[model samples]
Target: MKTFFSLLQKKLFAENAPLVMLVGLCPLLIASKTLISGLVMAAAISSVLIFSCVVISLVRKLIPDNVRLVAYMIIIATLVSVAEIMIRAYLPTHYVNLGIYIPIIASAGIVFAQADNVASKNGIVVSVIDGTLTAITFSIVIITVSFLRELLGSGTILSHRMIEEEYGMSFALSGGGGLVILGMLAAVVKKINSIKKSKKEGE
Candidate 1:
């Protein structure tokens, strides 16, 4: 139990999916143009990651090593399809905003990588915990980037005008702007890690 919690803590904070692991960049950079879009992407990916991990972990023993990749892809694609339909039906705006990115989540590699590597080797409980924490960490980074982008680019918080558009940095809405923000965030994460390393060394 102690080791489980320790690993969980590392996964959640020390190994951030976007900032540290650097997976799932396509949706993070493009679909995260707005806060809502980012949230929707996060939710979409989280659902696929969690459910696929559970399914894959449960059936790990039954799957052949040679065909596991194909199996994981099929499962992830199916889950993404379901997510797209439900989002389009219930949250039409977000569905449209997320656009092709929702479908692309199937090939994001982050989901399949985790499901294949960790889920295939671990128990159901461990897989679930890993999936949940990974999704949470991914959500945190993407959501924060979206929030900052929307605020700076449009001078609004969730589309509510917090600052005049004229004053907002329109560049923040562009891909280049996203890269800038991502770089800064990566730096911050690196600094934090260094601080933690120093503390550990001192102790």
Candidate 2:
């Protein structure tokens, strides 16, 4: 139990999927123009990842080792399809806004990484936890980026007008701008980790 909790903590913070591993940047860069869109994308990705992980873990033993990658892809595609249906039914606007990115989640490296490295090897409970934590990590990073971009690029937060004048930079709303911001964020995280490591060594 202690080990499980430790792993969860690491997944959430220390080994954060978006910031650390840098996976799933396609949706992160594109759908993160607004907080609402970013949240919706994150939710969709999370749902698919969690369900796919659970299903894959359950059937891991039955799948042949050689064909596991193909099997994982199929499982992820099915889950992504379900997620697409749910999103379309409940959030039509987001469904249209997200567009092709929703289906792209099926091939996202973050999802496949967890499916291959964690779900394929771990028990169902652990796999679920891993998926959930990974999703949360992805959400945190993307939402944070979206908040910054929307506030800076559009002078608004979640579509709410914050500034009286056009104080926001338009470039921040673009994909290239997102990559720059993400890179800066990664650098900051790396610096913070280094500081923590040094402090621990000094202690």
Candidate 3:
């Protein structure tokens, strides 16, 4: 329990997949145009990442180094397909809203990188823990981004009308705006990390 909490903190801050590592940015930006859409994307990605990591870890020994990347891609692609189908069959509303973006998880660099760096080298338990923490941290970041975007761009949150539509700035909801926000977020996190590093060094 202590270890899980510690790792969760690390993934959430020190090694955030989106804000820090910059993985899964495409979906993070597009699907996160709305809070609910971000939720859909985050859930789908969490499922795929967790499942792929476990499978890869379980069969790590059988995979050859020469073809490891190819094998990892196949595993991730297959898991993403499963997640997509599940989302489509049950969450038709989100499926309509998020359409093609859910399938993009298979191509996300973070998933493959985790599979190679953590899963392929670690046991199933460790891989599952890592995947779960990564997913949780990722979900938090995307939801935060989307909520801010929705509030700023649409002047509403989940259509709750935080402000009048007339008052809203369309730019906040656009791709360029998302990039600017993401870049800003990345810079803030980097600054915080640098300060912490300096403080530790000084100590």
TM-score of each: 0.94, 0.94, 0.95
Note the Cα lDDT for every prediction shown: 0.87, 0.88, 0.88
Candidate 1 lDDT over 35-117, as tens digits, reads 98888888988999999989999989998999988988998999999999999999998877767878999889689878877
Off by over 4 Å in 2: 1-9
lDDT of 3 at 55: 95
Weakest 10 consecutive residues, lDDT, candidate 2?
5-14
In angstroms, give how far residue 178 of model 1 lies from its true place: 0.9
lDDT of 2 by residue, 1-203 (tens): 89877776677556878888878888888889999999998898889889988999999999999998999999999998999999999999999888898999889898999899999999999889888888888888889999999988998987789975468898999888899999998888788778878997999
lDDT of 1 at 175: 96
Question: Ten residues in a row with the worst lDDT in model 1?
Answer: 4-13
Better of 1 and 3 by TM-score: 3
- In angstroms, how far off is 140's CA in candidate 3? 1.1
The lDDT of model 3 is 0.88
